[model samples]
Target: MKEIMKDLKELMMKIDKFNSQQLNMLVEHIFDISNEDDILHLIH
Candidate 1:
């Protein structure tokens, strides 16, 4: 879980310049995907 948190932090840093709407969409997409491999691919 700690590693996931680190990846999430890295992802947030990468998306820091995204607009509010884009960020919301990304967050929704992340939650919509129930597959662990897909989420890991996304975060990395």
Candidate 2:
């Protein structure tokens, strides 16, 4: 789980460079697949 979080953080850092529209789409896709706990983790 820690390794996964680390990798996700790295990926998010890379994704931070994307423009707004791309980020929005990516976020929506992620949310669509993510569970409730994952969504809570993301928002916090």
Candidate 3:
């Protein structure tokens, strides 16, 4: 659970670094690829 929270926090930080338009595009791309069964699969 702690590792999961850490990862989530890191992801939030990454998102926070983007401009609004880049953030929107990043989110759209994430949603598009996030259906690949597992988050770990995407990360690796």
Judged by lDDT, which candidate is best? Answer: 1
Clashes of each: 0, 0, 0
Ranking 1 against 2 by TM-score, winner:
1
The candidate that achieves the highest TM-score relative to the unseen native structure: 1
True-vs-predicted CA distance for residue 19, candidate 3, Å = 3.3
**lDDT of candidate 2?**
0.81
lDDT of 3 by residue, 1-44 (tens): 99999999999887777667796886677788756675456557
Q: Per-residue lDDT tens digits of candidate 1, residues 4-42?
A: 999999899777856677979998999899998998999
Ranking by TM-score: 1, 3, 2
Give lDDT tens digits, candidate 2, residues 1-44. Answer: 99999999998887776667697887897779658887777778
Cα error of candidate 2 at position 43, Å = 27
Q: In terms of TM-score, how similar is model 2 to the real structure? A: 0.39
**C-alpha positional error of residue 21 in candidate 2 after TM-score superposition, expressed in Å:** 12
Please say which candidate is ahead in TM-score: 2 or 3: 3
- Give the local distance difference test score of model 3: 0.76
Write the number of the candidate with greater lDDT, choosing between 1 and 3. 1
The residue ranges of model 3 lying beyond 4 angstroms of the native Cα positions read 20-44
Displacement of residue 8 (Cα, Å) in model 2 is: 0.2
List the candidate 2 regions with Cα displacement exceeding 4 Å.
20-44
